[model samples]
Target: MNALRCLGLGLLALALPVHAEQLPRWEVGMGVGGVSMPDYRGSDETRNYLLPFPYVAYRLEWLKADRNGVRATLFDSDKAELNLSLGATPPVRSKNNVAREGMPDIKPMIEFGPSLDFNLWRNEADNTRLDLRLPLRAAIEARSNPRSAGWVFSPKLNIDFVGLGMPAGSKEGWNLGLVAGPMFADRRQNAYFYTVDEEYARADRPAYQARSGYAGMQFLTSLSRKFGKTWVGAYARYDNLHGAVFENSPLVKRSSYITYGFGVTWSFLQSSELVDVGDN
Candidate 1:
């Protein structure tokens, strides 16, 4: 059932045109890469979960610019821009050790959330600048073999520095960023497979009815260069979670870990006409 939901969403994402106008204003992008989550505490030893993450986003510019819209655009300057964005992170897989004696099998997990972006500064002359973004997300995740599911709310802050200085036609450059935040999840999501009481709750791990919260922080940085109209970039991030519930949860015994990877990014749309030169 969970697999079907994931497949349906994946297909839906694919069915949509690479560049479609579902909303009044939007930009579309698709990326492929290798991702690894290593050093989660619950496991007997370090385990690396390799998977791919694909996503899409839609923005309503006119509405955002208006005070009556769901989100309002606060700042628009030649060197800076700020906007609110609602987005989602589809289901992805995670590898886990089942037998305790052998390697782990791949499992599935899903997440989605909303975010705000602030362009701190942009230098047309230098092409070097910085940007800040904050993403607040609420996610529901489930596992394949154990048949366990949970809900989590996370608020993450990211800072980016772009080294855009290069030859006029050069497509190569680098970007570095940092990510830090907190994640809170209910106990039902943290319960063990066998300990769940099915009679009380429809899902597993019903016995653990306590609300568990944790503060987790991660650092991410990336570097990339453009090829023709496409840009290739790679990034790495590390996470550390600390709190009573996180420390005691069986699912995440090791609260500190590192996730790092390399990927390619492509910008499908670029328009100088849409770019605003002054505050409206």
Candidate 2:
């Protein structure tokens, strides 16, 4: 079922073009920078490294109009947007290898998968408005030296309140946004690190499995701005997990982490011609 869903999403993204000049729209960008998370494992600092992420979006404008002096447009019926992204973060090695018991001796890392975005609102006046975006992300994660692999299906929501009304002279280009969501992982993925089976489980740790229930919740706030044709943003995120799913995991154990980072985006293409809408 999961593989089928991923294939379906991949097809959808492939069927849609990255750009539509008419009522529809599309955008693609790439970014690279450093990111860090503190507060994991009762420590002041832990995971920190450079990462690169790139994404593309395809929006089909089904409705366009002006109401109450605000212009509105709906893509995928105001419920969703076609989004695809790929990212990789360099592995983090422990400083005090001996002190890190139960911790994977290998590097800690993350990988991204297919995702979808649902937009709630957009302000036409300044092309900025409140938006609720959700991402259905699949993950391939690894921790410790043994190099165990885990798969996670994480769905996250981001609420964006763009400050379009700010004074032009001030930091008017800045937009503030927040993100919150939960993640679910399959038992196999969870068991890779959390569970202690006779063969797979660690020697000192008791038997455990990453459960299918609500694994964790995350909160993030971000500020974004545009400079000429380039876009720049910075964000801070807090992660908290319940029970042993996260607390017992070798990679992300400790239950909580704070991630802060900045990134720059560059557009590769732009078109003026609109998509030809056929008569139905």
User: How many steric clashes does model 1 contain?
Assistant: 8
lDDT for model 2, please.
0.44
Best by TM-score: 2
Q: Tell me, by lDDT, which candidate is best.
A: 2
C-alpha RMSD of each candidate structure in angstroms: 9.2, 9.4
Q: Record all residue pairs in model 2 with backbone atoms less than 3 Å apart, i.e. clashing.
A: 21-274, 22-274, 22-275, 104-144, 105-145, 106-144, 106-145, 195-208, 196-201, 197-201
